[model samples]
Target: MKRLIPLILETLDRGLTRVNPLVAAALWHLRHPTRRGVLKACAALPLLFVLYVLVLIPFTPGIGDIRKAKIEQPARILSADGKLLAEFKPSNREWVKLKDISPNVVNALIATEDHRFYQHFGLDWRRTASAALHTFSGDRQGGSTITQQLARNLYPDEIGRAPTLTRKLKEAITAFKIEALYTKDEILETYLNTVPFLYNAYGIEMAARTYFDKSASELNVLESATLAGMLKGNSYYNPVLNPERALQRRNTVLAQMVKFGKLTPAAYQTLSKKPLRIDFERQTEPPGPAPHFAQQLRKWLAAWADRNDYNLYSDGLVVRTTIDSRLQTMATQAVILQGNQLQGIANAAWGSRAGCSNGKDLLATFLRETPDYRAAKDTGLSDDDALKRVSANRGLVQSVCESKTRVQADFLAMDPRNGQIRAWVGSRDFSQDPFDHVQQARRQPGSTFKPFVYAAAFEAGAKPSDTLLDQPVEIQLAGGEVWRPGDEDEPSERPITLRDGLAYSRNRITAQLMQTVGPNKVARLARAMGVRDSPLEAVPSLALGTSPVTLKEMVSAYGTIANLGGYVEPVMVTRIEDRNGEVLADFAPTPPQQELSADAA
Candidate 1:
């Protein structure tokens, strides 16, 4: 038993010896580190330090030159000898260097945007830390250095940030690269050019030109301050929306300039003495009469740019328009007064009336409610309600509605000899909404159709004094459609002269004349007379202008008639050139075609 006990104790002693060596080996590994591991830690610490100091520490500005081609927009509306009517700057985006952006303007930007601009590197660590602390506390804050902003501005897609560590790291790397490449002045210049000023208004140059009607170099201190103040919040400080607040913000920028030593104390005092009291309402030039001309000019310029494969907004192009200012004024006024009055008379007869017999009271109501009625929407009212409104005041509403008492006028004047549109007014007010009626809207011509009908009759061998039956008649069509034509003032049968028929706008006589001349002959005559879209089947009622036609076609046809049958295609553009004075195109007169006899035309 004793020998067995001794064997057991020896086996246990060997097991304990083996366990101690293994435990010692594990303890040695826990206490000691590898040289490779130590070397890696040393390398990583300096790498992080270097990244903070060299890359993340400094703010860098942006740099890139615009690769834009310069072209000249076409000069539309020209005189016989190629004299210009109006000059246009359609989508003109010129890059004026920062040097030209007055020193006051630069100072204003620096004062309001970055007071400690010169002292900070690519990133202002203190401001960054403050922003971080604020953000951590659920407060919104931004203190991006100019360089970081420049990076974001230059590479919009790449530098889009969401206040994440990854974005910050990327910003730091890009900022360092930008700073290394671009000079401070170049950075500032790029920043100003790329920064957004208003809705779709990118760059300080565009803002200056758009708001002040001047170049950046021509801006005064007040204007500079006002522009600089917009960088923070363009919509919030819009001069058009919040003039008082905008002025106050601008003055604050000026004050900051004085505090930052960018402005002389005396200069600041003078500039800050009073706000630039710009009367938003009255501080504008009266718009000229070439609204339609201007609109067409823009369209042509856009098409020209597209044809040349150029960016209209980015390409710096100077466009000249063809608007005879004097003629435009005359034509616009004529159309406004004469057209409105004619429309009024038409309204008095055909419009819905409340069954009132008094014409004076009806006209009064028309005059009173015309503006509102024109401004109101055409939809949402049921047919019954509309009729009720039209019938109110015993036919007053109906009478007023008949004559076009509301504002709707279109004027188009062109040289019949050359087809150069000299003057045009699309609507009475371009400021209201520039839906150009001159070229866009097609309205019923009423008696205006008589001229073409008469010309057709003359071409068909009917003389000016030819007699036509003015008796009431019913027109029957092959499709079984029946239409009874009547005169406005006469109910009894009568005979009328061709000239008198047109002068009186008699429906029955004109309808009979159409039938005698043949519908095909009249259609052919209408087309040859410059009616771009010819009237449907010389319908019996076409003589009364039941058809729709554009002002351009009407004016073109009328001008041809006045000029004795000579027809020319209207030319809105006269010349096109490049910024370097190179001619691109010069408009030539389209040959005149004789469409009607001398007496007929």
Candidate 2:
């Protein structure tokens, strides 16, 4: 039995020598390799088990994988003229270098959380022993160093947050790997940049901006202390939501600085008494110009990212659009100005109950559709009672009236030469009303369709001087009903030339001409000229622009005419590149097609 015991101890020592030497030392004594040696081994069995998990089980690989860890960045949306339109960040963080971070914050963090940060390799043996003593006395204390915390922060699922011995050992192994791969300053830089803060913010840069409305470099001593204190618990020490607790935590951080000689005692005493005075503007990315255009482009870019196996939010893409910033500004301003005038005219007509179109109270109809009224009804209130309950609030009634009376407009401009979209204004204000009217709303072309009808006649070899009678016309319909067309203005009172007929917008003259060339001919020409998607009914009324088509299709048709009968799809995004300026994708206008003869166009 004695010979078997030594042999078994020799095998265990060889296995543990490759993982940890302390386990092998405690496992056996060569002079007395017996039952006594097994009793000594039990003292370090927990460590033996941890080492087994670390190397033998291979829960994770090595430092090579840790080097691949990266912080996510938002995509930059830029205009053609090099103007920053907006930013799209899902996590809402901005990365800043370690040099930009305040020294006060660094001092406070090191002194309070890990005083022996530079002295220890990763685990502070003195603090660990003291923590063990405290745990034995029923006073549990966390002895994790900054690097250890950073390990768990970088790989939460791998290292884990559970307060178990196995998780702690895994965290320690990762910390050692991190220490071997990076310098002390590099570790500090990553640790500060990665930690989370309150208000949907991550990293010191965003936290500084969120709490103090200042950049990370511009943080003062008090502001730095306040931010450093938040590392313990973000919302628990939030200056915006819980100021009293935040104040107490901030003073504690200041005391640590004084103890570590980073701050003078007199300064700490004076600073500690001061109230927590943060500017406290919850920082959010601005919804900049051409937000409507950028939103659609984002979807296309998202699809591209998915196909290429990249994350749109984290890959740090730069999208350069074809929209001119100056033209976009002018277009947005024009819509706002014209929309306000139209809104005023509409409000003046409907502001009073007497001036209503059908003498109906528009306010009552608007209020009945409100969620408040619906909720009141759902709670068993009658219609009349729900109306009274909702109407009691004057603000709600005024907002509803304003919303119903508002005038919405959309504008778009594209380059005729290459079909590049120069400017786009989707609405008067994207925030108040996000409904895009340019690509989505279908509006009647009205007199705009007159020119396309003239094109069809010219293609049939009809001259501009060719005359048609400018008078009312009657025809038989498929439903066996009489169809008569009237003129908006009094007909020229005689036969008029095709040019004069177009100039006067003579509805009857155009309708009569629709019969001469055939309705099918005009529709075939309309679709060829860019009215491709909307169904065009081949009727006499088609010449009068009775069919509704998308503004994009109409704009495309107009662009085709200007391009001398050549059609090209409008371009929005010109190119997208990765963070290192490497081109990921480039887009151009679609290939041109001759839809109409140059002479007819």
Candidate 3:
């Protein structure tokens, strides 16, 4: 009765004559003794919430300034004549204007992804309320508009969350902020540039160029529809994976476009019926006379990528190699034909003996397991370990036995003045065994060593026409190894001029001359003649091609002579550009430096 008397007094004080009990309670509170405390709590609650919103839980700038994204400079492959050979890949996000994109495309995206894009101030409250109702009713529909998508792609993790009330409030604030900050077209453009289209493929520019080998501006109605359809589920509707699903998705976009009046019904029907035609022309490899050059270039690129910390497959850096395409082609064909001829001769010569045939078959079988068909079995080698176990002399004998083709061939050609690799053949064929015999292989120089020996002699005051005897002679070595040197002309001892010694590649004459001119002196001369590896010491058989030499060193020596004793270091890349169109590296061929006397070399 006292409480009721107090409530009646409070209701009377608030002048609530016809108040219901609930209204009476509100009136009582309005006039109650603790009203000041209740009002203060209400005011403080909103202030604390505002402080939380403004201070700690405000919108964050995600992903930093996108303009600072790192880019690999696209590699530009060029011909010897400086013509563009090929571009490694076209760039993603090469922008196109809204006018350039089909109106239907723009309409379809708006209708499907964000219907109220034009009308809203970056956010729609009515839709937000409906989304809240839908979420409570167990339907989780994302109300992200095209602008929201762009904001997210350019800066994900901002408005995208579990659709909490606080997050929704923040998203609305941020979306409004973005709308105020950027224009409608600007937002749309950003969306086009950052959207992912397919697996490992990003942006509409790359999508258009990759799928149709065309530009976004060049996308026809059907093609635009296809691209639009990819947005629903890029991997699922990818034309490359399931064309039927892609076509159906595309038709859906087209139908939406017609319903929106962006595309006429007639236009949609025509586009839907047209064949999906695209020229899937694979990128052409540079034409080269020396395919071995390509193999070497590939190896060099692999190493370069490792050194430069680039993923060759994923990092979008373009690599340009120094190769004359015409020369590469010539070199490849020459090796292929030569390998075939030699392989035929080897098979025929060893065909009569069952043991040799079996060995050859074993080699052939091993080679067939590889990509190279030219790695025909060499019956001359007893086993894989035989070459390692035997002396060089025995190895030479085995090489000769296997030399039915007597045609061991290896070559290296480079631009003498600039050091650009023009042609290199490792083993007459890359597809045969694919072992890069040129760069990573060592082989006997045969008579090729004589030129270096003679160059040494000439540098030591011997003339080209100097006298030397090409007679057969047995000589005792200082190291107790005895050697008998002979010329192919053979048998009778004959006096031949040093000119003839070099021209005919006579062994005895060169050996006898080595005796006259000490072996150490000859080795020094070989070093001067471009033998980069340590020169072999003078020995009894030094004149008979005992030391091994790489094709690079051999060719450098030959080219030094060809260039009138001028030597130039080889270079491959002319320049490397960064993605932002900045020159990261620029290379120019330097003039030749003199390494040897023209007269001696």
Best candidate according to lDDT: 2
**Which regions of candidate 1 fall more than 4 Å away from where they truly are?**
1-108, 115-230, 236-286, 311-326, 329-410, 427-435, 457-467, 476-506, 517-525, 533-538, 559-567, 592-600
Residue 56, model 2: Cα distance from true site in angstroms? 12
lDDT of 1 by residue, 1-601 (tens): 9798657656655675578977555444434558876787688997887776566333322333211211223333343344444444332344568888877778888887776667766777888899889998999787777778776765555655576765676576666666666677876787777777664556777777667777778878889899898877889989878888898898889889888887788987788777664322222223444666666766777787789775455444444445566777788788778866765665455443332233465544554455434323265565445444554644445455444445577777888888888778888677764788877888888888778888888887888788876677788977999888777665456567898988877788888887787777766777787887645556677767877888898888887887689888887766665556576667777788898778776
Ranking by lDDT: 2, 1, 3
Count of residue pairs whose backbone atoms collide, per candidate: 31, 0, 19
Question: Per-prediction TM-score, please?
Answer: 0.58, 0.66, 0.49
- The full ranking of all candidates by TM-score, starting with the best, is 2, 1, 3
Alpha-carbon deviation at 267 in model 3, angstroms: 34
**Candidate 3 residue-wise lDDT, 1-601, digit = tens:** 9699877776475675465667767665665649686888798999988887676344544222333222323345555656454444333345566677656556767766777788888776677678768988999776766766665565456556664666655555555666776678866766776688754456676677778887777777787788888887888987876888888888888888777667898888788886655433222234334445555665666687688776443355544456666775577677668876766676566663221332444434433343222222243444443433322334333443453333445666688777777656777644444566776777667778777777777777888777765466778876777788775566455567888888877788888877777777766666665677745756646676688777887777777788877877767666655544466556788877676678987
Return the number of clashes found in candidate 3: 19
lDDT of 3 at 358: 28
On lDDT, the stronger of 1 and 3 is 1
lDDT: worst 10-residue window of model 2: 351-360
- Candidates 2 and 3: which is better by lDDT? 2
Candidate 2 lDDT over residue span 1-601, tens digit each: 9799778888888898888977866675653567867777787898888667757326743665577564555788889999998777666677788898888778988988999999988889999899989998999888989999888887898767788877887888888888888888888988888888867788888888888888988898899889889888887988888999999999999999898888999998899999899887777665688988877777877888889887677678898989999999999999999998887787687854322332256666788899988999999999888888888877777777667677788899999778888888888998887877887778888878987898899888988899987776886768888677787576566889999888888788788888888888999999988888888888877888889887888899999899998988778888899898899888877777998888888
RMSD of 3: 14.6
